[model samples]
Target: MKKIIVVAGLLLTMGFHASAEGYQVNLQSTKQAGMAHVGAALKLGAESMHFNPAGLSFMKENISLSAGASAVFTDLEYSKDGYKHNSDNPIGTPFYLYAGFKIYDNLAAGVSVNTPYGSSIDWGVNWAGSRLVQDITLKSFSIQPTISYRPFEKLSLGAGLMFMYGNFSLSRVLIPAGDLESLRPFAAAVPSLGQTLDNFKDIDAASATLSGDAGVKVGFNIGAMYDITDKITVGVSYRSKVKMRVPEGHAEMNYANETELKQMIATVNPLLIAYKKNPIVIPPLDKGTFSAELPLPSNLNVAVSYQATDRLLLSGEVQFVGWSAYKALNVQFSQEVLNGYSINAPKNYENTRIYRLGGQFAATERLDLRLGAYLDESPVPGEFLNPETPSMNKMGLSTGLSFRPLERLSVDLAFTYVTGFGRDGSYPYVSNDQVKAFGGHYDVKALNPSFGISYAF
Candidate 1:
């Protein structure tokens, strides 16, 4: 029975990495995203509150407000063992809002609301790999209140308080026929396992699902921006890691179908009877609660902005993600029979560096055009890659335009296309304490379009 508990989580992790940034989302600003997120040292209206709070000190107005939304279309394909399969096309919607004010001659304050991490994956209930994952969804959002101070001209410093909330859910199937290791230890008592081991085939015991909600988590960030020359500006920022946990949530477990299950039981019962051993008794799958915890990676960003001409601005940026701090995922369940039932998987994710370049051209006093590109690195090594996310090093192209139709109002629009190189990987199915292997390959692509409007008063 204990071994059965271990086999229950075979594919529980299949849905862990749907969002980019290794489950982190980077589309907080459509304008910045359109510029491949290269505006660390550039003035970006009120939206700058989220990217670099210190930028607020450069605002041209006493009060500013901005809002935007993004739509993402994604496709993921897999091929293995001469079989080609793909997950359902997943669509993600992310949005953000920002407000800033010049509180004093040298001080600025602002607030931001945004979806920082989120995405959903569906593998269809009857797909070849359905046994591993049916559906998985992750949603996360954050609120930040920031303040910036310019103690001296040309230099600004800022800080913010972060509050976050998230939700997670994962579903998969359980195999009844225990793998060799799971049954081997109990083989002495259940003589039938040894007698009919070769005759038994792995079949569904039940459909299992776990869902949890994150309690409020807190973290902080700080930034510095300085003007080196009349046309050059540099900025650096850091966001600390957030530790989050789902206190206690619900789990659903039950037989999805009964015809085949009854037949399998009938086949094994007589064998146990003849061996004078207790007949195999499948227990009812009970619904209960569970707990889980995960850590949000820390981030460091740096960039330099250059005014190449009177109407042209260029910027280059670098960002480092501390994914190595993510070591494992732990889940604990509540139930007498599953009293200590838990699942823990090692991630061993690595830190990654991202490069971005962008330029903005002022076509007219009220019209601006932006162009940018970026190369993003995946933190998961090939050997550790899993179906949960088909993440790979990616190259992205983006463009956007900002128009001021009214004296105090500006509207922004942006678009981006991102794709990954093919990646192949295999996952080990664990039974008892031993592992068996399976192989597969994955290819993924995404298209995102965004809209925004801002007002300066």
Candidate 2:
């Protein structure tokens, strides 16, 4: 039972990578998505709160509002030992809303609501890797209240308070049908137990479901921006790490041969004691609860943008993710129910960086064209990769356009394609005091389409 809780924590964290490289989502703004999410140095009116809040003070209008959403479709394939399986991932819709007000000549205030992390992936229950993970889903949202100030003509600073909420559920096979033969020795010692085991020896009979809610957590986002010249700007932003904690979670067990399993356990207990081995304890699922904690690593972004010509603008940025903070995962179960068993699993994730470049051209009086690309490094090591999150280095290409039919209203559309480099990896874990490993080749790809509308006056 303790092992189940430990594995559940891993699945919950790993499951977050369905939409991005790690537990992150960058679909905060349609305009920025078209530019590979690079807007740290650009003054994007109300939509700048997520990228760099300092840009808000540079808005030219008294009021600005933007709302957008993206549909993410992902495909993942796995192959090992001539066996193949594919992930049935549902379409993920990440959306954002922002409203900014110019309070004074040098002051701006705004609020943003968005889905920064979430995922859903399902591999059939009978798959080869069912013992590791069968299905998982995670959902999260954050609300930020931000303020920006221009202390000087060329320098602006900003800050925001982030309130975040998240929840997850996952299922996995507890025991595989192929491993039942290992218990034949004990079964042989008890005649009735042997008959019960032989009756359904090849059936995948046991599984578990773990679900939890991460209560509200608080964090902050801060940023600074400076005008290097009339046509050049530079900016830096930092988003603090938020620790998501599940105080009490639910776990349930299912057995295909419940009556037979109970009978076998009762029959085998005396034989095991005769051999001086510990007896199996039935899991107390009806009243048991679990607790866990996972950090939503911090990130820093530095960017520069140049207005080269009257109709052309170019921007670039480098993002440093502090994934090293996630050194391990810990889960604790209630002592009253399970003897207070706890497990601390080491992850040893390393920090990574992302590179982005984008450009926008004012094609006509009412149209703007944009193109961008980015390269994201995988944070998970090859040896620790698992089926739940087959993370690999990836490249993304994007294109978009904005159309203005009315003077104060603009419509936006953007599309992005992401492809991961094929890789083979393995995940090793301990089961019943024995080390076991699961390995395979994985390939992944995703397509994203976004639409939005912004109005400023």
Candidate 3:
């Protein structure tokens, strides 16, 4: 049963990728809680290592450590013509860890392990759209070690080396049997219908293959922060994109009968069967590479904080993400095995900009509370929204609290609500220019809540 489930999961992953909107995963960390408080580290503690490594320059402690986790919920639905289907993904948990220290009077260094990208979708096998894409699983994790220097009392510079690892699995079903009859007329037109039939049979037996891959990559980030005054600050950073390659992978096909397929080939023109075997068996076996050139989108952040009677702080920021550079998923394979299977993603995707505003209040000498909101634009077009990575414009609302039971120990907890623009699209089963079947639009949605703890030594 487990093997069957695994195979089914693999098949679902393939179908989803065939229709995915972007090759990138959407696993942004909850570290944004600290980002909400512009002075979180410049005047507070170590969470700055993630919000802006440059903020580490303001750390006064010899050592600081922080860890946290979040529970995410996603709901999706689809509609087309007069039919509709929906899927609600179970709550998922993602985590993060960060450690930093003041190395010298003007310098600081830190390290972090966080899940920057990942998501999973599982639609029931009986759903009408399941044949198109039943499930999708993708994970992107990174370890970044950084250094920061305060050149002046009001300015800081930072840089980090990043090591990233990722994995992807997608699946769907391809009905080659249903397509054979549609090609009968074309096959009959060829003179040798028997030979043509043999070729078609081989293709059908090999048409659908379960595919998956895994890989590793590395990159870097550089940033700067400037304190314009006691109440305002700004930051700029660039993350270099990294490329990952899947060295070896596996592919499988759902065959009704291995014995019958062999017998049919022996009785028919075996040469034609052998010639067509390459397209079916060997083609899916090729070691294809999945390279993700995830350039760290350049970001510009300007933040302002005002002190209301030295107890409450209000802050807001505007950010821009250089997403336009993320234009395609360039796939490459060995020429000997995959002569015609390489594909380049379509080029309609564009970069996105985000706006964020929030405030924090120090209700007590030892307690801090925060609230924030942000609007994020969608990078995907309507035509590309699919079961895998179904992306849309997103809006978020968040609330968090920090407690200081001791002078050196602090605990922070946060909750966030993320919603996406509902979308519609279609998937068609086509091989050799003929459509055998089709599935209509579907919908999805998500929510996330998180918590963290920090200690200073």
Q: lDDT of each prediction vs. the true structure?
A: 0.76, 0.83, 0.57
lDDT by residue for model 1 over 328-429, one digit each (tens)?
A: 877776676655456787778899998999888999989889999988899887766766666788888899998999978888899888888778887666
Error of 2 at 201 (Å): 6.0
Report the C-alpha displacement of residue 100, candidate 2, in angstroms: 0.4
Distance (Å) between predicted and true CA of 70, model 3?
1.2
- Kindly indicate the candidate among 1 and 3 with the higher lDDT: 1
Residue 387 lDDT, candidate 2, scale 0-100: 85
Q: What is the lDDT of residue 228 in candidate 2?
A: 96
Cα RMSD (Å) per model? 4.8, 3.2, 7.1
| Candidate 1 Cα outliers beyond 4 Å, as residue runs | 1-6, 10-15, 176-205, 258-286, 431-434
Model 3, 78-114: lDDT tens digits are 6667766676555566677888889898899989887
TM-scores for all candidates? 0.88, 0.91, 0.76
Top candidate (lDDT): 2
Candidate 2 at 364: error in angstroms? 1.7
Instruction: Tally clashing residue pairs in candidate 3.
Output: 25
